[model samples]
Target: MRRAISRLKPLWLVPILLGALLGVLGVLDVVPDFVAAVPPPVIVTAIALGVVLFAVHPRAEAHQPHRMAAPVRGRWAALNTPGQQLPSHGSRFLGQYAAVDILRPTTPATPAKLRKAWRNSTPQEYPSFGEAVYAMAPGVVTATWSRSRDHRARNTWQSLVFMLVLEGSLRSVAGRAALLGNHVIVRHADGTAAVYAHLRRGGVAVQKGQQVGVGNQLGEVGNTGNSSEPHLHVHLMDRANPNAAAGLKMTWTDITRSEEIEPSLAEIAKQPEPNAVLSMPRNGEIFEA
Candidate 1:
C-alpha cells in the first residue's frame, strides 16, 4: 500500500476538483450566502495545498546509475546530459532527471553548417533522422507507440521561445504520449525500465511483450513530440509507467571514444577519456560506442 501510494502523483487534483465543484454550484445558484463567503478561505487553502504538494513530491535518486550499452551507433553528440547536471531536463518530473539527447553531427563539422542544419533543415536532411535506435540492454518490451508525426525543428531562438512558452505547455497538459511522441518502453528483469523517445512515425520494429537484447533495433530516430530537432532521447527509470516513475542515472558500457566538441556551444565540466570502458558523455561531447 505504501509503495502504491508512492507511485501516485501528488494530490494537486483535490484542490482543482474542489474549485470546479464550487464554480458549478455558483453557476447553478445553489450556493447559499454563507457558502458564497466560503470561496475566499477555500481558495487560500487550495493555494497552500498546492505549495505543499510541490515541496513534497517524490524525486529521483541520483546515486543509482544504471549502466547499459549505448543506444545508438557511430558518431553522436550529447545534449541535456546528466554528466553536466542533475535533473538534466531542468526537472525531475516525467523520469527525465538523468535523460540524454543525442544526434549525429553534420559533416565538415562547421559552425555555419551546424547552425544552418539546426535552424532550417528538414527532418530527412539531418544525419540522425531515420537512424536505427537500439535497445540498451536485454529487456521485455512493455510499451510501444509510433503514430505521432515528426514536427519541424525548434533550434532557432525564435522557434525555441515559442516551443518553451506555448507548445511545451500544451504537450505537458496532453500527457506523456504527446510529449514523448512515438516511443518504446522496455522493462529489464531487475525491474528498471528504459525509454526510447522521439522515434520515427511507423518506424517501431518491435511490439509489447517481445524480448530484446542489447543493440537490437527498436526504431529510427525522428523529430517528433516535444523535440527541438531530430534526435534520440534516452532515459532510465524506476518503472515502465513514466507518469509515476523516477529517473535513474544512466551510463554507456561500450563507449570507445569521447571527444569534447565546440566548448562554446555548451560547457563541459570534466573531460572523459577517449576510450573509457563505461562512460556518460557530457554535453558538447562527441562520442562513439
Candidate 2:
C-alpha cells in the first residue's frame, strides 16, 4: 500500500485537478464564452487524460546502497535515517526515502541542555551550525542554492506547532528552494546524484558545474528551509532533479565509532563494534567518521 502511494507523483495532480475544474464549469455553464463553446470531445479528452494520469503510477526505482565517505566529521547524531525506517523522512516524495538528518550534540550530554534546546535556542547555538559540510563522493556540482535565510529554531513547542500549521504549508507551496534552503546537488560519474540540503545562507563554497572530489567542502549546516533546528540533510537520488528522481540507498564507508543517545538525553551508551562500512545511523545514534 505504501509503495503504491509512493508511486503517485505530485505532478499527476495537475491533470486531475484541471479535469475536475473544467467538468464543474461545463456542468454549471459558468465558464467563459470560449470555454463553454468548446466541443464535448475536448472536455472528454481532458477528463480522459486525467484518468490516464491517475492510473499510470511511476515506478519508485531502488538501487543497491552506495558506499561513500561520511559528509561530516566528529560526533553527530543521526535522525530520520533509513536504518530507522523506510521512507526515512516520512515520505517517498522528493526522493527523500533514504535521507538522513545529522546534528552535533554538546559534549557530556545533559538533560538540562536538551530541555533548554527544546524550550528555545538560536541556530548558531547548536554545535552543528557553521560546521563545514563535505561532499561524500567525487562529482560535478550540478546545482546550488544559497538565498534562503536561516530562521530561528522551531524546537520550542509553540514554534513547532506554528511550523506544522503554517510555516510548513507556506514552504511547501513556495516549492523546493524554499523548503531546502541552501543546497547543493552533485552528480557522480555513475549517474547517481548526491543532495546536501539545509545549508547556511552565504555558506555555499562551490559553484554549479565545478568538479569536486570526495570530502570537498560544500557548505555549512543551518536551520533553514523546512528544518526545525540546524542540521545537515543528506541523501542520494537517481538524478539531479529530485522531483523526477528516485532515492538510492547509501552507507557511510568510514565510521570509526557509534553510540546511542538515550531518550532522556541523559546518557550516551556505546553501541556494538563499529563497522568500517556503516549503514545509515538510526535516529538518536551518534557516530564519529
Candidate 3:
C-alpha cells in the first residue's frame, strides 16, 4: 500500500501545489490580471543560448585516404587552348558542376545564350585547338560523339538580333555539353568509372580497345555534342556505359581546398600556392584523408 501510495502521491501533489500557488497569488494579487493577456516573447533566452552553442560547435571535416603509397610523378596538362586567350582564368572549365551551376552557367553566362550558338563558342560541336584532355582514371571508351559543326561567331548588332530570333531553331542544332559528348569512360580502381567528356572530334588519342594509364592524353577538348563553352568535363560514375552511368560522390587528390565559385582562366594560371594543391585523381596516387 505504501509503495502504491508513493506513486499516487506525486500525481496528486503536483496539481494540489499548483492550486495552492494560484490561490495564494489570487489572495495577494501578486500576479497582475493583465498577465493572462500578455504573450510570450518571440525569442527566449534558453533558445538563444542553444543557438550560440550550435554556432560554436565544430563541423564535420572529412578527408580522403591516399590511394597509393608512392607519390604520383605526373602533372596535369595545360587547360587553355593554343592562341585562344581565356576571358578570365587560364583554365577553360568554369564553375563547379554539382556544387555550382548544376545544369547551366550561373553568372555572366547563361544556358539559353550558350545553347543559341554552342556549336562554335562551346566545345559541344568543335574541339578547341590543341586542348588535349587526358584520362583521370582508367576505364573504357564506352561512348563517343564527334559529328557536329560549331556555330559561326556573330559580333555585329544585326547578327545578335537575328540570333535571338533563331533561338527556337538554334536549340535543334545546338548540342548538350553536360551530356558527355565525345567522351570516354574508364573503370576506376575503386570499381567506379571515370568519365571524360566534350572531347575534340578526331582528337581521341586512345582507340576503343586501348588501355590508358593515369594522365594519358585521351583527346582534345571539343564542342561536339552538348556543351556551353570550350571546356572539358570530368566526373566519376558507377557504370561504364553512358546510358547507365550513375554519378558517384567523389573527391580528387592534389586539389585546391577552398570554396571558390566560378574560378576564371586567370585564377588558374598561378601554380598551387605553397602547401596548396589542385585536385587530380590518378592511379597509384596516394590520397590523404
lDDT on C-alpha atoms for all candidate structures: 0.76, 0.75, 0.40
Candidate 1 global CA lDDT score: 0.76
Error of 1 at 170 (Å): 2.4
- Top model number, lDDT: 1
- Each prediction's RMSD over C-alphas, in Å, is 5.4, 6.5, 20.3
Task: Output the better candidate (1/2) by TM-score.
Answer: 1
| TM-score per candidate, chains pooled | 0.78, 0.75, 0.42
Model 3 TM-score? 0.42
Query: Which rank order by TM-score, best down to worst?
Result: 1, 2, 3
Looking at model 2, residue 177 earns an lDDT score of 82
Give the Å shift of residue 217 in candidate 2. 0.2
Q: Which of 2 and 3 is ahead in lDDT?
A: 2
Tell me the spans in candidate 3 whose CA falls farther than 4 Å from its real position. Answer: 1-129, 151-178, 257-289
* Worst 10-residue lDDT window, candidate 2: 268-277
Candidate with better TM-score, 1 vs 3: 1
Ranking by lDDT: 1, 2, 3
- Tens-place lDDT per residue, model 3, 1-289, is 3223322322433433444455577688786666435442422333444333322211112333222211112222233211112111221111111111011112344233323442334333232333666666655555555554434333334445564576422332232333445666667656656666656667767766677676777777655444444445565444454223333334345433222222233333343333222343221121221
* Candidate 3 backbone overlaps, count: 40
When 1 and 2 are scored with lDDT, the better candidate is 1
Clash total of candidate 1: 0
